[model samples]
Target: MTDSTYQFTRAITRRPAASVVNGLRAEDIGTPDLEQMLKDHAHYVATLKSTGADVIELPPLDGFPDALFVEDTALCLPKGAVLMRPGAPSRMGEVAQMAPTLRSTYSEVREITGPGHIEGGDILVTGREILVGRSARTDAEGVRELTAIVSDWGYRLREVFTPEGVLHFKTDCSLLDGETILSTERLDASGCFEGYRVIHTAPGEEACANTIRFNNLVLMPAGFPKTADILGKAGFEVVEINNGECAKLDGGMSCLSLRF
Candidate 1:
């Protein structure tokens, strides 16, 4: 509805813990290097703060390997924040760990207490509505429950489908602006973004699809020169962060923080 979607005044991020080496992944690529992840994470936070926004850096959660991927824990909006119910049993506790911070940040907060599960990664909030894809981490019942909760706030929720084997809906797409989406060809072919301007990642650079547009800059994973060139040509200020370590854990720029 408002520019709060990308023009955020604040963001919440958690530092990666040593146990991040054991973070969940769709497949085992290689163990993530905590040292490298920390370095990249610092660069990320610093970049966010550079935009003159308040960035809250929460401490690491060693007990929870995927805690650094804070975006999966909640869906933050201008109206309020909704805590998600992750389908991953090991990741369910991450929601509770993120609750107190959100409760303190927003005047109103809601939770998805349900028989179904949904993770924030499966949701994409645009200027018009909320698009949620049913994935391994998100289900039909969870989408129905989320719709009911956000409906009270005058938000419309649309149910969509994640490509087979994708870890999350956002693994293949991201909003670059109110009406522009940066996506992979496979995901775009699904026709979900028909009404929006879609920018396909380079043929072999689909890994760069999971980026974030925060304020004046677009933070994307490094190593995708073609996509970066395309984004620059499109007038987006791009910042490339080395994602070698996080990539091993199936994480990207969007997973690092909760913007609002």
Candidate 2:
């Protein structure tokens, strides 16, 4: 199937000032106004449809408060959906809820079980390769196991390490197309998969790393003016929405939905 023919699911959530994780204490950060956050999420959903995407909503899962933004821990592809084992134990329940939603849209759905944990945010699928990150959130075991399972799909799996303070791979890098990638300046250029044309973003604009491509349009967070300009210069029709609240919870444009 072509990349443009896939479907996606996005869950809208109430703004949470802090995220709780096992071993790690909850982090408090200044957040966007609740009303604005809701508005932003709504706009994001609407934008997805406007761009000719098939959008669905996953029924909210209790206990897993972060399940609303479904994309953080799962990825949808032509063959099947990969239900990731989130590194944050607090977010593990998300995969269970995600599996059913994926099944509704695609016939095959699978899970990445582990001695290693993986997060959807750490995995990037290009036309020819799957880039998995070795981060505090994703482990080598998960990478090895998931790679083995996806080998049949003809995707070459490559690994990249998330810089110490960067929590997820997608937080530092996003595949824009088969050849272009949007990445943070902090990532070591030598470590990226060879042959990718890298577009480096300014330091604070790293949030730009979280972009979703549907057809020819790139969906991204609205607040980063410079990043949007950069994408525009690259000939992409960039669609930006304010995801300030989601960002406060360590989420970004791509985190709001699971696109098949």
Candidate 3:
């Protein structure tokens, strides 16, 4: 399994249920317009498939309001997948729901059984190293479990702390490739991205830090012109999508899919 985000061959995503407006959100950003959200999600899936990945589209789980953000439930690796136990108690059972899908594709599926809570969003798999963030959603035991599981997969592990205002580690950073990172000023100053070439999201476009690099195309949220300009100048082909609905629930480009 290479650490590069551009080396992925497949991805998994889920349809947002009608009850998505009931999903978790930090800032009371107003409710997501369900009708438009479905439209945007359809376009999102299309954009992902256009990147040449074999997209696994899962049906909506009406019982789980935030199930559309499937990346939080598990992680995809070259060797296998790890079913996560999300730190938010409300999101716990999502991991169990994702297991059948993982079993169908992976050979070495692992689980982070509590008193360990880890969400895929708090983990960054870059090249041969795995960076786990110590956040409200991922504790010390979670990081330890992640380390033990990834060690056998031949990955070097390191722990970084998520700043108070950030939701997840990846929320402020994304791998442009194995050697380059697109991040926000806050995270660049955190020392978690020392060895890589860190490109700060344009000053007012911090949300751009959550974009995803799939193969050569950068899948980013629309409405962030400055950051898009920077990425364009950096030589990445950008594919912007309207993420207003998803953003209402704290979701982003990477959160909607699990790529590997």
Highest lDDT model number: 1
Worst 10 residues of 2 by lDDT: 16-25
lDDT of 1 by residue, 1-260 (tens): 96667898999999999999889988998998889899999999999999999999999999999999999999999989999999999999999999999999999999999998999999999989999999999999999999999999999999999999888999999999999999999999999998999999999999999999999999999999999999999999999999999999889999999999
* Model 2 lDDT per residue over 1-260, tens place: 23533233433222322232211223556644556766786787777777665667444344665765576667667677777888887878777766766677668777887878888888888766788888888999989888987887766788878877787888877767767888887774646756768888766887678787766678888778888888899988898887666676677777777776
Best by TM-score: 1
Q: Which stretches of candidate 2 lie over 4 Å from their true place?
A: 1-27, 188-190
| Deviation from native of the Cα of residue 179 in model 3, angstroms | 0.9
TM-scores of all candidate predictions against the true structure: 0.99, 0.87, 0.97
- On lDDT, the stronger of 2 and 3 is 3
Alpha-carbon error at 248 in model 3, in Å?
Answer: 0.9
- Which residue pairs does candidate 1 place in steric collision? none
Clashing residue pairs in candidate 3 are 3-127
lDDT of 3 by residue, 21-43 (tens): 89998899899999999999898
lDDT of each: 0.95, 0.71, 0.88
Check candidate 2 and list the clashing pairs.
7-260
Q: Taking the candidates one at a time, how many backbone clashes does each contain?
A: 0, 1, 1
